[model samples]
Structures are given as structure tokens and as C-alpha cells.
Target: MAQSIAIVSPAVTIDNTLGALFVGFTVACCVYGILLSQIYTYLTHYPMDRSIYKLIVLLILTLETVDQALIGQIYYHYGISNFSNPLTLIEGAQTWSFILQQTLGSVVGAIVKIAFALRVWRFSQRNFWITGLIMILTLGGLSLALVFTIKSFMLPDVFSVVKLRVLGTISLGVGVLTDIITASSLCYFLNKLRTGYRQSDSLVSTLIKYAINTGALTSVVSITTVILYNIMPNNLIFIGVFFILSKLYAISFMATLNTRRVVRGKGTDRQNTTANHTNIFHLGTRVPSMGPSDMAGWETAYTATSATQQEFDQQRPIIPLNTTGFQDPTLGKRPAM
Candidate 1:
């Protein structure tokens, strides 16, 4: 007797698999558009930015573009080209693009984290302890991510990829740690920079808020991705969240850079208004009565004061407040004779 083979249609589980991917891809594209605008704003408005900074922005833009293209290929392979093949969709075959995207995502995450680490280092006055810890965690996460990608590539299907859950979890967990540390360090250092002037402190507070917001956003998304990956290793639900992870990193980094303009503008405005009412040479300093023979000493003191003010301004990363003209409120009104 000849046996008849029955055809099994694609399961509804695709809602969490392909459906999740489609939604994530859509959101990622939207974020990518925002990133493009940010890049344009950064380039057009801040042409004087350091070359290294420009290179970093360009590099992230290129990587994100390639990542999106690879994601498109994955969609095409599974959703379009293989539309008729229910078995492939159900099996969750990991294509080359899928694997490459995971690896590239790790690279983008590491780059962003390390860039933040550099910022922390600068804000912390090159504190090796804090910066070193962040760098180590970032590198560790990247290493684990690479390992996970390699193992996933070696596996035949998404189901097999589940076997590396511990590895993936650890990698993402490290990323979470890095994000928290980097943000906390930034806030701590920035708070220390508060000079007690209302405008200056407000700027510092804004910076701290930005650090918390960016770090929290990236960390939350990472946590969600890892949880989804572990809970449903067989579905592409986790991969869907992973799809937008790199884009978020890029957006956060660019947004932070672009904010410098807002800060600079506000600081300049505060500086100009304060300048109109205050003596440009007497701010944050007191002058001693000098004799004609002491003219050389006065000149030396003025030069030294200018150098110190310049150094202090340089220490501040986001808002370079020229403290020369801004009066510190703590110093009460000069006594009238």
C-alpha cells in the first residue's frame, strides 16, 4: 500500500518569530532615519569638530547601513524568497546575513561603549580605575558576543543556537554592567564639576540627565533582548530586539554629540548676558592694589589667572564655560569704601 504524505502549514508561532522581526526592522529603519538626520546636523553645524570625532560618526553610519542591508537580506531570504517554503520558515534557518548581523551588532555595541568609556575617562580626569573597568567589561562582552556568533554559525539552525544561551546571556549582562558604570561615572564626574553658578550647575545637571537617559535606554533594551533570547531560544523574537540594539547605540552616541551644540549655545548666551553686567577682568578673582613698579607682577598674575581659567574650561567636556566673565554667587558683593 502506498502512503500519502501530509503537508504541514507554517505555524502561528511566526507571530513571535517573523512578526517580531518585521516590527523590529520597521522601528530600526525609523531610528536609522533619525540617525541620518543627526549625522547631517552634526556635519553641517559642527564642521569644526575634531577629525577623530567625524571619523567615528562616519564609521558608525557606515556600519549601521551595512547592518540594515544585511537585515533586509535576511527578510528577503525568509519572507520573500522562501515564502512558499513553510518548512524553512518554521525551522528558523540562520542565514549568512543573520550570523553576520549578530557579529556586526557586537562590533557596533563595543565601539559605542568604548567611545563612552573615553568620555568617562576624560570627565574623570583620566581616572584609569573607572575607565579601565569599563573598557574591560566592554571588551569582555564583545569577546563573548563573538564566541556566541561563532557557535551560532556552526549550528545548523536557530534551535541549535539555544544551546549557547549561557554565553549570550553573559555577553549581554556584561554590556549592561558597562552601561551602568559608564553612566554613573559620567554623572559623578560632571556633578563634581559644578561651580555653583546657576547656569553652570544647570548645564551640569542637564549633562547628568543625558548620561542617565542614554545609559538607561541602552541597558534596558539589552536586558530585554537577553531575556527574550533566553525565554524563547527557538523563536526569532529575541533576534528581533537584537536587530534594533545596534541602531539604538548609534542613535544614543550621535544624540550625545549633537547636544554639544545646544549646550554651547546656552553657555555662550549665559556668558554674554553675564558679561554685560560684570567686569570682564574681575570675575572669579580679586585684584590687589599695586604700585607702578608692580606693573610686571600684575601682568604675570593676569596671565596666570587666564591660564588657570583656560585649563578649567578644558576640563569640562560638554559645556566649555569660560569662567573668566561669570561671577560666582558665593563671593558676595565687593565691599564699598
Candidate 2:
């Protein structure tokens, strides 16, 4: 009797494993382009946004830039610098830039989630419970993610990362939960603000939809990363997905800020009509629409508009917004806040 066994070198599987990382890098580059456009739009359209808001946008952009450079170098080391040394690619996901890129990604995620948590706090009229919960989950996810990233560095190779699978899964699980809760709470508070007026209700509905969409993209990707990590722990499929995570978070953050333009425009057009009494808020001074430009201004605008509606329902005299006027350079007239 004779028996034959075929042996395959792990390096040969680079086509599937390293290939995943390459493809992921390619996709991340495309998302990066989109992020640039969004940032440009934000700067142009919302120039009046608070300094802190602009600073955050620029900071995240800078972080993402470094992250991209790190990813590029990691790939160069795998695909170009060590082309003949296939075993190097197969042996590990470790590179000088690899851990840094990974940890930076987690940092980006934390920043974006915390920003949203702050938004929730404002949108819910400073609901401590909901805002606190979101912040806790965000921090928890970030901490676990950092731990997993650090653990990867100590590992001998990609396959050895299997021991840390539970840590990875838990980190991603917390991220998903945070995303869901953040989105749901936003929708709930927004829906609660809906007045019986068709125009007001429609605007609230639009915001709710936006909330769902912003939360959904990141949650879906996080879920996919989790699934792939568990199912293909030995491969770079999950790493590829992980590469795109920061980009999506940045995009979501930008989209949330930029959408205020569309909503504000609609609210403007709907004003100056017979529905004025019902939907239009008559304020003593002009306040820019609710936007991240200035949390204080946004809070003032929100308080004016939301409080006006309640007062109207109670048949009380309509008190004008007491905040100081800030002209919208884009809109010739003071637009509805």
C-alpha cells in the first residue's frame, strides 16, 4: 500500500490573505477621497460652526491621514519590500506601523462615537442617563479595542492571534451595541419632538431617518468585521474590513454635520407663508440653525424653536428667541434656526 500527502506552504496562501489587505487598502483609499470632499463641503457650507467643531473635523482628518500613511507603509513592507520573502507576509500582520494604524483606528472610532454621544446629550435636552450610557459603551469598546490591538503586537504571527479572538469579539460587540443605542436614542428623542404640524413632523422624520442611516453603516461594518474575524481568524479578511472602519466613522460624522444644511434650507422655504404661525419661529434675533459650529449657539437655537412650539400648543404668547443675532452669510435673510 502507498500513501501520498500534498503539502502546501502557508506563504502560498498569500494570494487569499495578503490579497485581502491589499484590497482593503484600496477601498480605504476610495473612502478617503469621499472624506476629503465631505470636509470641504463642511468647511464651505458651515463656516460659522463652532471652533471646537471645526477643530475636531480637522483633527480627525489629520489622524486619518496618518492612518492612511501607516497602512500604505504596512502594505509596502508586505508586498514590495519583502516580495521574495513570502514567508514574511504569511508569518504575521505585525509591522512597525501596523499596531499604530490599528490603535489609531480605535481612537478615531472613540472620537466619533463620543461626538455623537454629545449630540445625543443636546438633542435629548441633556438627558444624563442616555448620554452617560452611550459614553460608557464607547469608552468600553475603545478600551477593549486598544487591548486587542496591543495583544496582536505580542503575538508571534497571524495564526497566533486566535487566542485573542474573544477579546476582539467583545470589543466589536460593544461597538455594535454603542452604535445601536446611540442611533436609537437619537431617533426616540427626535420623534418625541415631532409636533402634529405636517411640516414639523416631516422634518423630525427626516432627522430620524438620518440618525438610522448614520448609525447603520458603521454598525453593519463592525458586525461584518466581527463575523469575518471569527470565521476566518487565520486570514486578513477581517483586517481588510477593519481598515475601512475609521473612514466610515469619519464619513458618518461629517454627514451628520452637513445634513443640517439641507434641513435648514427646507425649514427656510417652509417659512414665510400662511403656515408661518404654525411652523415658523419668530425670534427677536437671528440664530444660525442647529449645527456643531457652536454648541452654545446650537443649544440656544434648539431651545428657541422647540420651546416656541410647546408655547404655541399651550396658547401662550410667542416669546421671541432671546439669543444674540448671528447672520447666515449664505442665506440673505435670517433662516429659521
Candidate 3:
């Protein structure tokens, strides 16, 4: 009777690692909810943004949902149910979920990279070459991932991902480069757009810092995955790292989109007006809430509402942000070289 009910102990290490992975996944899902909350805050905080930006939010939500679903399925079958039948683990490893996660994760990462590249283009007033380089890298990384998907499943009854090392290496390499270029381009353009006025310079600096922080996150995770894969090709550690990389990418981008108020709060160095009216920041013109353009005599009491509505609107159009967090299309652009 005892022999009939025996459990395998050899699978314990892998099982524990998978348990850790699921814990990470739960935390990741919570972080994703935080991203959704930011989106909700953005909607309530401002007037309607452009339709395209809203569409992008919806697309990200859908992709992340599907991404989580794919992995969740594998976790349920191979990780949870197979605990009682360790032999089933070998047979259950790496199926369509394995293939689709890589593909979908790459797709999500590419969308974010391309979105940041477009931001650089906007800041540069359409710097064709710089933006073009970023876009090319984005496409290159994405194409390699697609090739990996094809090659991975193309073999005769074999789905050994380790066999596609070259493709995987290049794909991750290009992705890191893409993120670095995107972050650097935005900071460079923002630096050049500095108005020589102290108040505006403070705002631009805040933007540069935010760009660097968000940009570092996804790139660092990708680099870690690459290093792990090279050092442990036979192990599942790399798979665990790759599993959460997509969530990091999505969270970073979504936070950036909805961070106007957070960024604006940093710009207010002196005493602030009430929160409800304090967050408005017009990229090119003087903040209506902050004070008059003449910061030389800047005073908190000079609230925007105290001015005539038509006059305030004409100065900067009270236009809410369009998704990419572009403060003002005309306000912040590099002077032509």
C-alpha cells in the first residue's frame, strides 16, 4: 500500500522553482492592475485624449491578458497537476504555450519600443534617420523572434528551444539596443528643447529622469535573460526570467503614458495650489495653475482659474494629453541643427 502511494522526490527542485515562478506571476498580475488603475486615473484627470491612444491602451490590455493566459495554462497542467506524476513532467514540458509566449512577449516588447521611437520622432520633429534606426532595430528583433517560432516547431517531433541559440541571442541583443536608443533619443531631444528659463528647464530635467528610469527596467530584464540563457542552456531559469519580461515592458509603458500628474507634481517646487487644480501642465506655454509666464515674479496666488476662461484657453488650449504623454506637440522640440 505504501509503495503504491509513493511520490517522486527527484522533481522537488524543479517544482519549487516553479512555485517561485508562480509567486512572481501573482505579483506581476497585481502590478498590471496598478497599470490599469493609472489608465483610469488618466481618464478621470483629463479631458478625452485622441482615439488612437485609447485604442493602444485596449490593445495592450488584450495582449497582456492573453499572455498571462498562455503561461497560466502551462503552470496549471505541467507544474501543478504533474506533481503527483513526475514522469508526466517530461512529456508535458514546452508545448504551444512555450512557442506562443516567446512570440507574444516579443510582440509586446516591439510595440513599446516602437512607441518610444515615435516619441523620439515627435520630439525631434521627425528626425528621419534616428527614428528610422530605432524602428529598424524593433523590426529586426521582432522578425528574429518570428523565425525562432518557425524553426522551433519546424523540426520533426522536436521542440528543443536550446537548439535555436543563435536566433534567441540575436533577438535579445537587438531588443536591448532598441531600448537604449529609445531612451537616449528622448533625453537628448528634451535637453535640446530647454527654453533657457529656469522653470521650464526644471520640467525638462524631470522628464529626462523619468525616461531613463522607465527605460532601464525592461532592458535590464532582457539582458538578465540573455545572460541566464548563455550560462544555463539546460535549465529552466532563463524561462522563468523570460516569463515576466513582458509584464515589465507593459507596466513601464503604461505608467509612462499616465504619469502627467506625477511628473507635473515634481515641477512644483514652491508651495502648490489645491490638488484638483495643481496638476495641469501645458508643455509649451506657462502652466495656468502655476502662474503667469513671468516666473521672475512667480506667485502661487495667481491661480489659472482667476484668469478669464477664454484667455487661458487661447494661451495653451487646455488640451489634455494625447496618449504618448506629449505635453504639447509644438511646445517641446529641438532647435534645428
Best by lDDT: 2
Give each model a TM-score.
Answer: 0.77, 0.78, 0.73
TM-score of candidate 2 relative to the true fold: 0.78
Error of 3 at 203 (Å): 0.8
Q: For residues 1-337, write the lDDT of model 1, one tens digit per residue.
A: 0011013333236576667778878888888898899999777765655677779898999999999999888888877887666467555567889889988888999999998888887667688999999999999999998888778878876556778889889999999999999999988977876665666567677778888999999899999988988877766788888888898898898887777646543332322232221111221112222233433333233222224445666696785568788777868888779
lDDT of 3 at 16: 41
Please give the RMSD of candidate 1 to the true structure: 11.5
Ranking by lDDT: 2, 1, 3
- Per-model clash counts, in order, read 0, 3, 0
What TM-score does structure 3 among the candidates reach?
A: 0.73
Error of 3 at 274 (Å): 26
All candidates' lDDT scores?
Answer: 0.74, 0.75, 0.68
Residue range 82-153, candidate 3, lDDT tens digits: 667544543344567768878999998888788778778766768899999999999999999999888877
Q: Which should have the higher lDDT, number 1 or number 2?
A: 2
